[model samples]
Target: MPNTSRRTSKRDLTLVAVLVVAAIGLITYLVVSPPGGDDGAAQQPAGPSGPSASQSEGSAGADESPLSGLARRDEGDPTALGPVDAPVTMVMYSDYRCPFCAKFSRDIEPELIDRYVDSGQLRIEWRDFPIFGEQSEMAARAGRAAAEQGRFWEYNRAIYEDSPERGHPDLTREVLLDYAHEVGMPDMETFTADLDDPSLDEPVREDLRQGSSIGVSSTPTFVINGEPILGAQPLDTFVEVIEGAAGQQ
Candidate 1:
């Protein structure tokens, strides 16, 4: 008879290789599609979904990660928080009308600011990915307008804190103007003018394009360092990921 033992060993090795490929595929699916599934929010076509091999490793070097380049790290960016050179940078792709985004903003963001941002370990950058509808875009433009007047964060807080516990809010133009006033925007005249300014729309569109190109189909998606964290995950989850990324740096 043939060498039966050698044949079995070869078969085992082949099975192992297949299993490895399948595992990678599953992880890619999880990272791209996320848990809640598509809610028909994506207005643009999604690109390929899957992080590079380095993204799965907590200790992976930033230079080796394709996603790390996403962090703008612009110190002068009005919508961003924390230092430009913070050890860990999180690029948050969020929509104004997303309830889950509001939840994170109201509940977890303050803690993050106190624990990590204040300590100079983390930088959070905001990208206005308005996927909900027309009002969503309007709200996004309003945020940019608020940013111009140095009240972006305050406006952000007003919107999120006042949002309903579930579903999208009615972010009408009048409502947005009211929020601008409520946030104590220094120049309501300029803020109002900026809201109707067509140029302000480009930044919002660019943010949405950037997010869509990276397979972000939903709001509140985050790219922490090089790793993608989908949905409004628990605060502990953020801590773990942020700490892990900090450790790598």
Candidate 2:
């Protein structure tokens, strides 16, 4: 983790709490977004250590080698998102509103879980990058609320799996709570209260500020060591980045 020095303001924390809840709403948008999140909420892809998203577009040649020779398929954490204790730490700045974040979580997170996180070789950290959309904040808060019940992964996964479903609904507190109920989480009242806990606000703001310093401008921007890997890429890209990071230690 990076060193902490900056202090957050009251407004920032307030925004943090709201963003968490809006994350749920963002997931709802995913259900109605185009495949691969290419229009509207999906913006231009940024450059990477290798080829940029622009380099592989328009011609329709396909990027089969995007992450070639990058990672070995492996089993990851079935029930967790962050790392337990990894020598290499991979940090992600993601907005629930960004369909790309949904894609990355669905496609790449599993490989990280199977090969590195589950094996204790790498520790992965996710920082909310809600992008301050209409309801992005809510979705993030919803995830945090679920985290209080040790069911963050379940809620996050549920959102991804349903990203392609028909119809849409605002990701309200009731909806998040409902998902919690479906996932067999603990008491709803207790977890729901944690969502409003003033003490929890600081961490969320701190994450936002820290991510800004590293040039992250969108969802699913990743940093391995001091290098940046921007965009929602294939799992193999993650493998290359993660393995390089793990080898550093």
Model 2 — TM-score against the truth?
0.62
How does each model score on TM-score?
A: 0.77, 0.62
Error of 2 at 17 (Å): 28
- Judged by whole-model lDDT over C-alpha atoms, candidate 2 comes out at 0.57
Error of 2 at 63 (Å): 32
Candidate 2 residues 152-205, lDDT tens each?
788877776555321223566676677778888788878778766766555456
Pairs that collide, model 1: none
Q: Highest lDDT, which number?
A: 1
Best by TM-score: 1
lDDT by residue for model 1 over 1-249, one digit each (tens)? 368777867755653454355345434644564322342222222333222234334323333444555666655889889998899989898889988799999999999999999999999999998878999999999999999989999999999999976667999999999999898999999999998999999778778777765666666788897677776789999999999999987
